[model samples]
Target: MRRPWGLALLSLLAGVAAIAVALGPLLASSGGVHGFAFSTIGVGAILIGLNALRRNRRAPSAGVLATAVAGIGAGAIGSVAMLGMLVTSPGGPTLLPFAPAGPVVAGSTGQWAASTTQVTLTSVAVVGVGPTKQVVVGNGGSVRLAAGYSFRSATSNPQLDVRLERRVAGGGWTATGIEATVAPNAPLTAATPAYSTTLATEAVQYRFASGTSASAPVSVVYENQHLYTGMAATIYADAAPYCPNTAVEIAHLGGREAGDYAPGALLIRISTAVGVRANLTRASQRALALHECSHERQWLNYGGSQEGYAQMKAAAAADFTVGDNGAPPIEHAADCGAMALEPNGYLGYGGFCTRAELNEGARLLNGQEY
Candidate 1:
């Protein structure tokens, strides 16, 4: 009897549909490695079975049908593997979804550490940056960070004045300090300032005085910090750095918003500059992030809005010592909230809003009514 090849082809299509339905949740919960590997194997096996059926198009026999059946059975191998994984583990579906969460104490950097100022800054800033990365996990996690940087004088006749700097998640890069003893034709013993950061790695950057290098640093000797499991807000670098001196997203340009308020999700905003070098310090970039985090809390916790933020700031200033016209209420309240996250609540009290570089970046960093 001639084999009903059309019926077999339909079976292959049906099997694919069934696999998608059955494997979807498993693939999602399979935690990346096992899920991806086994899924590929399973789907690949089914495809192979279907292809074999197609090759013997002329006259099909019982032997050919048996081979097709065997191939199709191979696809079931994934379901078997997934079942094994579920049976082997005590907790059926627990996996490392993100960095772990746990208890944490904010850092006490004492007074603000000084850095080279590109522009006279203002009282605009970001607060509670360290905690953004130091998450509290239940099963434990690691935040890969770098402490110090090492460099070499790429120039043969090197007139090198090297400085080391670091920035954390979506914050500005700050100059740590100049290196010592970069002698003639020796190893890259010059030290750059040591700084730590997290994978919001978009904002995390290391600045070495290789102003004219064809390549930028893509990798770092990152150190990791173990953490417990839970969810928290984190800042990530924008796809493209902002146009020079433009803070956050250019709200005026089109439909994109710098930050937005929604349920459960926190929107932390940051400023980006492209070719136009922003005159900013690491501290200022951080301060800017803190200010944005405050906005996040405001949006998530409270309904963050222009009118609402303004009203709240006025209320807060009346209760607290919110300085003169130097820092606008919206910016000032953000700074205050940012400060509250510090070990010493007032560590960055006036750090961000009280600087000169606070001009365009400041007014626009968090979007002030000023």
Candidate 2:
């Protein structure tokens, strides 16, 4: 009996592909060991069945039949595992069939820590434009809430319910309706929409909930009421070590720019129209301000506007000519710097930063003067 070389080769190739799929991005993102096990078992069983078929092409042996049956059973289990991976991976397909009713009680126990920034009056400024006319131009700032969770679970699927709650006037906690279902074993970082406290002060709290178990409430107070004020305040605070005299103000940029930094004036100007837009969230607004502040640090490091602007222009022109990575070196540096200052909040850079740039950004953020 000539060995079925073609069948053997096909089985090997299919087995390798199956294993690759098992250990690929889906498994990496899910951070689940069960996925790997199921995938391995499924691949092994399928290979075993294929081998049995190749060896017993003419004679249907009882042992081959039993082996094939076992292989099928393992393959079914593997299919279920693959389905779970798809459901859990970020941006993966939704598990419409297995969707839960209400919040799925987390299968694992976890604890969460809250990160909050308070809105302050310093972010808002009242200026007298004329003898009798006064203009309020700075942001009134809002409370920003972000949570990081750590979980311990023995089960294959572990999820946690994260919620951001606000304290009402009567002191009762009300759900802000901002929530997310996250895997416990993975990097669990969740944030609520910035609470608008520009009209009045607000108390915001956050927690992690799982099957009637909840982490202790963590809270922060926001006490400012001007548009984009909190974002400006956050930028100023983060930039204080680098640019002590940094100032932020709301200005009309005529839709030409979201924000800009004036080197000599030490001013960060945020667009009024952009800030007031309904869809713009506070986190994104803060990210914009921080990006401008990075330019401010760059200017100070470069000595003055003459040197800084010249270098920036040259970099921009070169980037345009070469079509380098969609952003100029200066802009890329600023994006990295902003991310360094607010790792969880800033989402502008789209993860295009190099290691050297990221390190420089950290140094620039930490008062590394020219």
Candidate 3:
């Protein structure tokens, strides 16, 4: 009995072709032009694949041409996915530097006052890059970690502590302990209580307490020798605003720093002045990016899609008495985008922007005065 090799091959090719069809939308959302092209080919492949399967059941050789086309489509999709990853990876393209950089080291001197100290970082370096891993911000001066995560275990316990953690491969950071309670108001020699917990860590977090004036500057030292890697630090703005008529490149932002106001979104760009800030942390930057892009999306979607509706919202939103009844609904949506994208709320970029922030984001998105 001869095995049905031809039928088996057809099944394999069909399965891969289906995958390309599914990945098409994801690719389009992630990269746009390149994605769209890949998606079109993928769709075409599915059609060819169906025909090939039909012919395969009749005469295997009859499906050869279709199978070849299907394979090309599958290859096209795979190539696009790889290209998108490379283009967005950190240190890839500057304009669309989508990948987050290394983790940010908060304590310059590894010392935080006996107050509330919280640092949300990206990762904990498991590999080696530098020697500035353990951050202990003490009184007088500050300690700084270059941009990665590396820690030394603590020897004893104290009253308060600034915990640290490492980043998980998926996303978000988690904490275990620092081997000792780090008293921010007591001496390094001071010991309060003995706490014990056996847990491994991935990401890092800083914890600070409030309502205490014991005059004990926190003394944090290294405990373990493990180093965290792939953490990204803050990235400052390189250029001004994206001059609408300009092109994009990797080495250059061709835009502004801090808050990237494409001089505000579409219509907002027309009515509102640019509102780019400086010194925004990565979290804030992500939030701002999400908010602004939401505007651009809505504008291209609703405004461009329906000029009459756009005119009505533009006119009604100006009547101070009525304000904006979701006019250019993009405003409300942009706020939501900011809330969703922001991780640490550094600069109010993430979850739940205040009323003021919502208004501002919405205003800019609506192309109104802010």
Candidate 4:
């Protein structure tokens, strides 16, 4: 029993060492473990300690005190040394260093932070599919973020710079106006002087060495008021660029036609880059045309009902109108009521208008005595 006790203690410590090695990478940023080689060696030391303990335990006549002391010494030294290297000098990691705050500036070019003009830089993001990474800095009351830096480094080039592109929601990531850079050797940190934007719901993701990443999307709020039919139409037109490939589909009454419905022309009352740039893919154009045609047929059979139904479907799918606007629940309900009664065209009276207009439209559509 006494002989085996020494082995048990050593084996336990060895297991602890191995665990530290495996967890080293995960805790690297926080613990400051720099090189993979060092981590592996640390793990091996733990294994050695474990094996020593096992050997002594199996030797019935072995000196229990000797075996226990040897195994414990090996494990203790290896574990302490591996952990100590993390926050030390030379190759020591640079993550949790303390620092002073600074100033911030904003411009069309981008938002920047610095103590002086020479060191100033804007918060920028370079996107990629791998691990997400980010840097957050405060500028006055505002905060700026730069994310999506690649983990791999360039040969000979010590300065690791990343590129980011500007694009709308649902659009392919592009490498246009967005860009950011950081020094690998520098301590990970936050700078002072922040910048703000109206797009609070937007998210910025950060990746480190291409694996699992983190995202911080913004938050915001606003109100939308009721508008006349024509006004609503105009607003849609003005916000065309924001809605890209989107257009108002009006249901047309079926004249003495044989088919249930005839497709309506895609209207472009307000010129949006999406509307003006005729480069819509064949499939996209076909889908849009077909959708509108469905509305026309529905209108002839029912009055003013198509938009409401479509909007309702959109809501169910969690697909909200993006970029330029949103749809209120009241308006959605009103539109649904209008479609139930007049399936053909926009009766222009049901959706989110004044209570009087809505009640009157609802009553007439329901065939109730007004």
lDDT of 1 by residue, 278-364 (tens): 443444444444555554444322333334545555554543344354644554555554443331323233544334223422333
Which residue pairs come into collision in candidate 2?
139-226, 139-227, 139-228, 139-229, 140-225, 140-226, 140-227, 140-229, 141-230, 198-225
| Runs with alpha carbons beyond 4 Å of true place in candidate 3 | 1-64, 86-140, 147-370
lDDT of 2 by residue, 31-72 (tens): 345444546655665766577676766765655555555554
User: Which model scores highest in lDDT?
Assistant: 2
The true-versus-predicted C-alpha distance at residue 96 of model 2, in Å, is 73
| lDDT score for candidate 4 against the true structure | 0.33
What ranges in model 4 sit over 4 Å off? 1-36, 50-147, 150-370
Question: What clash count goes with each model?
Answer: 39, 10, 48, 25
User: So what's the TM-score on candidate 1?
Assistant: 0.22
Q: TM-scores across all candidates?
A: 0.22, 0.33, 0.20, 0.25
Taken over the whole model, the C-alpha lDDT of each candidate is 0.35, 0.48, 0.33, 0.33
Model 3 scores worst on lDDT over the 10 consecutive residues at: 231-240
* Error at 4, model 1, angstroms: 98
lDDT score, candidate 4, position 100: 19
Score residue 133 of candidate 2 by CA lDDT. Answer: 13
